[model samples]
Target: MGQGETEKIAGELIRQAVMLLMDRNEDITLSSVLNILADFQMRAFNTGQLNACIQAIADVSAAKSGSLREESALKDKVAGKCSSCRSSDNVTTLH
Candidate 1:
């Protein structure tokens, strides 16, 4: 298609995506819209913008997921430990 035709189609897609998110009570931020468009592109074109940045996005997501997992595990390990169990008298702070 011509550039103009492609742009018009993209504009309509954006409007539809935004309205769909609004209807679903989803957040309407740039990231939300872009994510929707990314999914649509995957469905319609089988690929697009993500081709350029997929590796970077994957790296970031994986790193954050690992960090969150570690944080959760640490919380689980540290929980239920009350330093205020006392030395038979006063309380102790867990620093």
Candidate 2:
């Protein structure tokens, strides 16, 4: 395939992967998401192409780190709180 074809395929794969993650409400971890993208790339293109696609995805998603951190913190806070405890003094925050 030509460079244009390779890039097209890679873009489609990345799009599908992103949509899957969004549908599942999955955390956008680069390593984990790259694994999925790499699998598709390996089948659709060369290893080099796979690496390039992953890099592109990482670049686009890098700004989302702060949002992910906030979401994780909220989840942790919810999980750590006890429903039976009403007073802050009776509840201990887990670090």
Candidate 3:
């Protein structure tokens, strides 16, 4: 799947999970979200979608555990900006 598609699926899964867990009076941790996604994987979601969803959850969890500023920075990264510098104009490639 393309990066944009992956991000969209991941974002949707994360958003809904937060809502569902809130309705159930449960905490919406990364693991909880991942389990929800995993259950969906067995029935409907494909492997690629599941993987992307899990990755996105992990990223959010990691950022949350760190500084609050990192959360905004991580969001920028989600938007395809460089995590270190938050720039999309300059391209960096490694071989």
- Report the poorest 10 consecutive residues by lDDT, candidate 2: 55-64
Candidate 1 local Cα displacement, residue 20, angstroms? 0.8
Give the TM-scores of the predictions, in the order they appear: 0.47, 0.41, 0.49
Indicate whether candidate 1 or candidate 2 has the larger lDDT. Answer: 2
Across 1-95, the per-residue lDDT of candidate 1 in tens digits comes to 44455555666677777799999999986567667766666666434333323433343346557878777755644563434454523333333
Q: Which candidate is the best by TM-score?
A: 3
Which has the higher lDDT value, candidate number 2 or candidate number 3?
3
Q: Cα-based RMSD of the predictions, in order? A: 10.0, 8.9, 11.3
User: Compared to the true structure, candidate 2 yields what TM-score?
Assistant: 0.41
Candidate ordering by TM-score (highest first): 3, 1, 2
* Candidate 3 lDDT (Cα, 0 to 1): 0.67
For candidate 3, lDDT tens digit of each residue in 1-42?
877887887788777777888899998776787667665555
Of the pair 1 and 2, which is ahead by TM-score?
Answer: 1
